[model samples]
Target: MTVSSETRGLAVVTGASTGIGAATARELAGRGYHVLAGVRRDRDADAIRGPGLEPVILDITHPDHIEALAARVHEDSQGRPVRVLVNNAAVQANLPIEVFAIEEWRRMFEVNLFGQIAVTQALLPALIRSKGRVVNISSVGGRVAMATYGPYAATKFALEAVSDSLRRELAPFGVEVVVVQPGAVRTEMLGRAIAAAGDLPAMTSEQGQRYSGLVRAINNQAVSSTNAGLPAEAAAKVIARAVTARRPRTRYSVGREAALVHVVRFLPDRMLDRILAAALRPHSAVTT
Candidate 1:
């Protein structure tokens, strides 16, 4: 953790109420950086109690909250510079493409894509002043698609591209953009995905019948996958490395599953497609 005397302001982590965000906040604080922990509600803010951490209520999808966060970061610094910004807030939609609601897609993008852009833009000034780092939390889905996760993967793919472009764009300013992709982390996101898949519209409804099989397959997969996921603490270790390392890597893929997914990305497309198809195929045979 090296910092010049004039530019040791703080690190701001969005989605800081729980899971990876909360873990990252604790990790950064342990590394000796003051942390601006952003949460969606007062209860979330209250939940994150730790040394070197100050909670801020910020809904990334809201312009006013974004502005308020920027103002607060600037005000707290008092001419000092923010050293790190972690854009970690995101949602995963686990519905079939055939049945997925467009509004859900919109919601994911609002927070995962546009909201990230908004917050990064807001924090750039302070980051530039400190020659800071931007660590974006993407997913292995960005590299490889999975069934029933098209909507979520789309956002992660967009985020990965944005991180790449920003890395190039921000280099001259002495700012760094790093993307961290974690695979199947044990988090509440998995629970939500599982629940959503089980509670679908009636089979007679438009798009519902088409996705019944897909939904059931996804629910089963999610249940088993939950046990296979890495701990949030393990992924947080990589975030800490990205934040504190002297020469942080441009990208980090944490956990065994994430690493394997990256390897899958390099495989022949048809072969990978076959593997994915089999993996997602339903266990129960169609009886009709």
Candidate 2:
């Protein structure tokens, strides 16, 4: 468990296939840390080509993958402590909560929440030994819920809650926990959610018909706004800084919009709720 003061230890980052995760892995490497990038596909592993970066095929939802990663990290570190852990993998669901299939909701939680916990638990020893930090890649949705993104936001909200508790519990152990909330980072996530909606049973159900127009408008608005959002690398840099900071913050919002969302957290519940409703409201809606 003893790491030389001069040598930077290993950093584990999940969901390093693309977007924030991939960029974070690269950023950490540039900051003089050995990075184990958790990617889920062969193509993703192939894509992350670098000197200090090593790609591990990791599907966080799978126990086998989690166990294998724990062993791999142990072997790779050679008793050296793990310096950082970033839980950045997530799935998205865009639909009215009333019509969102329970199965799909569960899947989102499995990947975004449960899997994240599993990985963290598996690596807890290494993190504790090194007194390293845990950086969770949450979203602005975690603080402010929006319609049509209920399921996705729900998972993040729960994640933020759990992360808060975990931070308190681990503080005594010298293991800091941090949450990085990004607002509409320029990534394929929004587009992928829209593209996958076509085939979801919830999107084809009767309730879907009733709420289809409202949901479509919300999704489109979200996509259109991405053009003005921060690039994934911006979040990556923030996360990398979190990993190496002498005294890292409990939470960091990476973009202008994310900063706004964080500030709005101080607003009264009624004020915030009204603002979110107005933002998610369809452009053409009947009003009294």
Candidate 3:
């Protein structure tokens, strides 16, 4: 049913076309919030059709779209506080740094960081008035880097910094900012990322010949291995908690790899490099 809970108020979930964002929108809807499910395509809008899910076309990377989104939010909320904003839309590209183009780097940051910032900026006033909270869905990449994920990881790491700064700055306004770092989750995004990795520098190139095989293998393994990860619904549950918790934590780590992430964070640089090399090095060249 279309929700009308006065206490739960309105929730805006960006990238709601699929994956964690779509799951999160449904979660918030079940919890009594009127969900604005943002998407880029008409089909995606249709996909999320249901009670409490009002699909809107929102391409966060475009300035005009962001402004229109803000206006729509303002109107739907009827000048009231928007209780939650979930910045869950993002994309990933996997390629060795040498094989990655400069424009690719810009595009990653534009969608993952800058676009998120724009949406938040436009909605800050509503958040402040409602004492609302913001939920940013970052990835384990934000905390740990892996081969062929440099460009994507950079954007997430930058997002972590942004979330930290915004968390402290918004404290006085009663507007909470929380980061939910998910290790991995079962979603269609994994397939798309693996498929897109094919476009990296040609295997005939010097650098590509040295690393492309290993890079593709490792990328495939990373995606396929994580097939056992929690469902996107699990990550959505965490985002929901962050939005509704009376005193939410600054960061919440989801998935079984949280302990591993801690180890990666505290290990010596030399030890960490050795570990990564052992795992990521070309298989035929290694021996016990």
Score every model by TM-score: 0.90, 0.91, 0.92
Candidate 3 global lDDT: 0.84
Among all candidates shown, the one with the greatest lDDT: 2
Separately for all candidates shown, the number of backbone clashes (residues 3 or more apart, or on different chains) is: 0, 0, 0
Q: Write the per-residue lDDT of candidate 2 for residues 1-288, one digit (tens) a residue.
A: 423322787888998999999999988887777788999999999999687788999999999999999998788735556888999999886888887778888899999999999999999998998898999989988987777778998999999999999999999999999999998789888877876666686445677668877876787677767878889898898888788789998888877677667578588888877876776665435321
Comparing 1 and 2 on lDDT, the stronger one: 2
lDDT of 1 by residue, 1-288 (tens): 644324456889999988999999988877777889999988888889666788999899999999998998788755656889999998775877766767768888998999999999999988988899999999888888777789989999999999999999999999999999998788888776656654645445666667767666766776666668788888899998888778899999987667656578579989887987787675334321
Q: Ranking under lDDT, best-scoring first?
A: 2, 3, 1
Name the better of 2 and 3 by lDDT. 2
Q: Work out how many backbone clashes candidate 1 has.
A: 0
- Give lDDT: candidate 3, residue 27: 92
Report how far off residue 107 is in candidate 3 (Å). 0.8
Question: Least accurate stretch of 10 residues (summed lDDT) in model 1?
Answer: 279-288
* Model 1 regions lying over 4 Å from their true place: 1-8, 77-79, 196-209, 281-288
- Cα misplacement distance, residue 204 of candidate 2 (Å): 5.9
Candidate 3 clashes between residue pairs 3 or more apart in a chain or in different chains: none
* Predicted structure 2, TM vs. truth: 0.91
